[model samples]
Target chain A: MDEKFAAIGEAMPRLLDGLVVTIELTIFGAIAAFILAVILGLAAASPAKGFRIPARVVIEFFRGTSLVVQVFWLFFVLPLLGIDLHPMLVGVMALGLNYGAYSAEVVRGSIQAVPTGQWEATTALSLGPIQRMRRIIFPQAWALMIPSLSSLLVHLMKGTAIVGFITLADLTYQLEQVKRTAGTLFTYGVVGILSYFVFALVLMYFMNALEHQAKHKLGQGKSLWRILSPAPPASTPAGGAS
Target chain B: MIGISAAFEWHWSAAAEVLPTLLTQFVKVTLLVTVLGTVIASILGLVIAMAIRVLPRPLSEAVKWIANVIRMTPIIIQLLFASYAFLSLDLITIGVIVYGIHYATYMSEVYRAGIDSVPKGQWEATTALSMSTLRTWTAIIIPQALRATIPALGNYAISMFKDTPYLLVIGVVDMVNAARIYGGDTYRYTEAFTLVGIIFLLASYPTSLLIGRLEKRLAYKT
Candidate 1:
């Protein structure tokens, strides 16, 4: 027990470093994925076959293949094509493209889920396609997609573990190192999984708050402040004035 | 750049030589793990969902917490941990079991959602008829729940299939591992990884389309 505690103490800094990398990968990859999702999703939902077809093909190709293969291909094969990238870049790009494809479906679905009456209202108001999206359509769809997107974000964070395979010392890799030193799989395994679980809980809390705020803005739900505070049912019932 | 290009080129001959090896490994390891894992996950997940439903509240909450922790953790880490902890077991066996249990967490949620989708009326009707508990579950609830769950289960199976490569950490020599070995031997990563990607796309694309269709059909029935 003493030896194991000593080993854990030695492993702490390295594990912290790995956690930072994992967090960085998740954040950057999410930004890139969100951008691609919006673009490709809009294109997929477009009436124009030219835009929709290409977007569909891109999404399918990325979605159909395994992400590890994508990461390996980028890391191993791209250098031969005179496009050498940093390992971090490779990790972020692979994650971005792969999860981007999945999130694109979420985006398209949420957009489609928006009431046709809203679209009709925009059309009746002589709103252009861009205006219809920006002013009325996107805000509603944004709220609808948040729950799905939040889950995807958690999955993406879990997926960051694969970056360790590509020689990036992400949290999983660091934990493996600790496991080797400690010679106790159960201890480190518990620590590793607990860390990830805590991270996921934090991410989910943030996403839920974001979802509540988005819905509240649309006058559909209680404010985030209210949700966070202790409920006084008699004082302010649901949908009641603040 | 010029030097690297000279050193690395896609070889049809290399690909042809490795194709048989990859395919053999794909069948022996990758597909085997996926099939067995899916079976284990499906049955185990249903059991978990039912357990949570029938058990006392505190016990069910404990089960739910365990499931969430497993679901949130990375499969690669789980694979590594299992491999280390179970030194007596075959690496492939460990891989399948770990994958099954890990994914069973996600599948349990799907099962729960499916079971919840079965109407309260159905359960009340079963009670009214004085049907045995097993009869109520097996005859009515499970069948209706399964219809809603099948497509989602199919998606998770495909996901499990793709994740078989994570077993490489435990030296499972799955399709991706075979490709990696071939790449190391021939110093031709381009063909091996690209071929692996193509193989994955080929296998999973059709399955996803089929699932999409299945989902639509199931939705109509529900």
Candidate 2:
């Protein structure tokens, strides 16, 4: 027991280095996913069949495959095309691209969840497409996306472990090194516990903050959900449910 | 170790030599694991979801917290912790316990959502009829819940297949590990690793297509 505790103390600096990589990956991944997903979401929600179908295809393709496969492909196959990127770049790019695809639908769905009346209002006022989105759609759309987006961030943080697979010295990789040197179960637990500590803290913090922001934003306007004809409460009255 | 040299020139001869065993035994192990993992995951997941049903609001919330805790942890780490942590302690039971527990959390959420989507009125109707709760859940709630959840269960199955690689770390010698051995043996990473991923796609793609169809059917039904 004491050995484990002491090993954690000794392992702190190296793990902290690993933690830095994890955080950097998480932050970059979240930002890239957010930006790309916004574009993806916009493309998906577009009226043009040309735009929407391809975007939907990209979204499902990435969403369907294992993320580790994507990372490996980028790390290995891209160099065959002379893209010879750094390992960190490869790891980050893979995660961002893969996750961006999934988040796109989430973004598109949330934005579309806004009532048709809101779109009609913008159209009636002669608002351009961008203006309609920026002013009318985004503010309310953000509220809907917040809960899911918060969840996605947590997943993104966890995804940093895939970096370890790419031979990057991320938290999981660091833990493996620590385990080899320390050879103790306690040290392994410490690694899980520490990473979990950082993850849970960031996750809960982001979620709560978003919850606060969502409440504040939605508190002001009469909701689009309200204006869209509300469904009856309780599926108990549900019909034709086999 | 197969060493570094044989890994580069990965030969058909090597893969071909392994083919007889690969075709039969690998398929048996793969199917065994996929089925076992899915069944155990479904059962455990339902139990966890039922806890949400029976538990008080605060307790359900606690269950959600536990679920997130599991969800946030990587499958690889959990597998390692299972094989090493428990095995070292002479607790082999803990390995299955870890997989079942971790996967169960996600599975439970699937069940919870399905159960939640079941009209609240169904429960009230059962109460109105003075029917036993178990009978009501069995006859009504779960049937609907299972339908609602089949796509999700299919997802779990695919995920479990991909996750077999984690077992390699625990000395389970699944396909990924098998390829690694081939890569090491013949100095041929290109073929072995590529084949392993192809095998994964072969399984995952069809399973995913099935899920997409199931989702469409459910959406149409609703």
Candidate 3:
């Protein structure tokens, strides 16, 4: 028992390093994904096939393949093609592209969920497309997308673990090393899962807060405390394709 | 890392030669794993969602927590645990179980959503008609719920198909595994991995289109 505690104590610092890497990868990957999702998702919903087709193809290509393959392709294959990126860059790109494809659907769905009348009202006011989408449609849609986007973000964070296979030394890799040296597979496994759960909860808390603020701005205000509480059973969506 | 300059060259002949074997593995292993995984996930997910709905409050809450933990954690961890805990199990069996259970968590949520979409009036109507519990669920509720659930389940199936590559972590000879090995031998990582991506695209893209069609057909009907 003494030895187990000592080993855990010793492992904490190393595990923290891995946790930092994981968090960094997730944040960068998420930012990239959000950018790609917004651009491609809007293109997909656009009237012109020229824009829509390419966006659809890109989204479909990313969504169809396994993320592991995409990451491996980036990490291993890209060098052969003369693109020598750091493992972190590769991890972020692969994760961003893959999850971005899924998030595109969320973006499209939420944007469509904006009342049809709003689009008509914008048109009636003779607002340009960009101006109307910026001022009116996007704000409303962003609120509806929060729950889905939060779920996708959690999935992307979990995906950071897979980057370890490409030698990123993320939390999973760190935990695996700890498990090996400590001779405590079960203990480390429990700790690793709990860490991920805590990260997810933390993420969800912030996302809900964002949702609360967005809803409030849109005049559908709810208590901040209500938003901070975990999504009740009826409201929670699936963990998605992760 | 070996002879880095020469390794960068893409040899067309070798890629052509390796293509058949990769396709064979794609069909025999990758597709098989996905089909089996989807079957297990669908049945288990329904059972779980049903249990959560029907079971008493405390038990259901406990089940929800377990499901959430399973759903939220990285699947690689679960795969590793399965590899360790079920040491006697073969890779295919282990792969199917892990993949199924991992996705089953999502599927359960999909099921829950479908069940929730069923109107309260439907339930009250069943109760008024004095339908038995089994009949109420099996006949009315399940059928209606399943219509809403099919597209979601199909999406999960496509996701499972792509994720079969992770089975390689457990040493299962999945499509990605086959690609990596071929690449290792030739050091032509570019062709092998690119081909693997292309094959995945070929398989999943059409299926997604089909699912979109299914979703459209089922949308207003329900």
Candidate 4:
């Protein structure tokens, strides 16, 4: 047990390095995913078949296939076609494309969930298509989609474990290294999972704050300040001014 | 690296040669794990959902906490932990159980949502009729919840099927692993990995379509 603790102590710097890589992959991948999701989602929700068809094809193809295969294809096969990308890039691309496809559905659903009254109101105001979506539909939809997007973001973080397969030393890979040196699966495994759980909790808390802020903007939920502060008495009404 | 001319070629013959090996592994490992895992997940998830509803507050909270931790962490690490911890168990068994339990957490959320969707009136109706707790669940609550849950459960099964490739970490020789093995031997990765992707698309796309249809039908009925 003492040796195991020492081993873990020795492994801390390397584990921290791996955690940094994992965080980088997740952040980059999320940016890529968010961009693709909005584009594909808007396309899918468009009135034109021209826009919708290709978006559907991209979304479905990516959604249907496994990420492991996609990552491997980019890593192993793309080079054969004379388009070699760094493994980190491949990992990000695969993660982004896969989760982006899933998030596209969430985007489309939330946009459609916005009431028809809002659409008619936009039309009544003579708002152009881009203006209507930008000024009205998207903001409402954005608030609605944040909760689902939060879950997907967490899923995307967990999905970063796949990077280890392609030889990126992410947190999971580092934990495996720690296991080898620490010579105990139970301790390292518990630590490995706890670290991820902690990261996930932090992410959830952040997303929850974001969600609260969005809802607060739309006049639906409590102020961010109220939510962050100490809880009030049980008899106090929600959204009341402090 | 070998020249693009030699490496990038898509030979139908190489694909055909690799197909049988990958397909065999797909049936033996991938499909088997999915079927068993889904079964385990479906049953366990319902139990968990019910336990959360009925168990005392602290105990239910504990269960929920465990489930969230399991759900939030990557399945790959869970597979690794299970494989390492249970050395006596074969990797395939560990794969199924780990996949099952990992997914059960997600499915429990689905089940919980479904159960919550059961109208309060139904519970009130059961109580008014003096129905036993088992009968209230069996005849009133579960039937309604299951209808709402089936399509979502199908989606999770498909998700699990795509995820079975992660079993490669535990040396399970799943379809992707079989393809990787074939590619390792022949140095022809494009055909094998592409075929695996195609196989996944073929298998999952139609099922997702069916699930979409089922979702629509269920919505109509409700």
Candidate 2 CAPRI grade? incorrect
Give the Cα error of residue A104 in candidate 3, in Å: 1.8
Top lDDT hit: 4
C-alpha lDDT of all candidate models, in order? 0.90, 0.72, 0.87, 0.92
Per-residue alpha-carbon lDDT of candidate 2 for residues A1-242, written as tens digits (9 for 90 to 100): 57766776788898889888888888888888888899899999999999999998777666655566567666654554445688888877867887898789789999999999999999999999999999889888988887778767776776677677667888777887788656646555556755765675777687766666665666753334433446734434547552
Could you give the candidate ranking by TM-score, starting with the highest? Answer: 1, 4, 3, 2
lDDT of 1 by residue, A161-183 (tens): 88877789988888877876677
* Model 1, global lDDT: 0.90
Better of 1 and 2 by TM-score: 1
Off by over 4 Å in 3: A223-242, B1-9
Which sections of candidate 2 miss by over 4 Å?
Answer: A180-183, A220-242, B1-32, B55-65, B88-99, B162-164, B171-173, B176-202, B219-222
What local lDDT does model 1 show for residue A101? 97
Runs with alpha carbons beyond 4 Å of true place in candidate 1:
A229-242, B1-4
Better model by DockQ: candidate 1 vs candidate 3: 1
lDDT of 3 by residue, B105-193 (tens): 99999999999999999999999999999999999999999999999999989988887887776777777888889988878887888
Say which candidate scores most in DockQ. 1
Show the lowest summed lDDT stretch of 10 residues, model 4 chain A.
Answer: A180-189
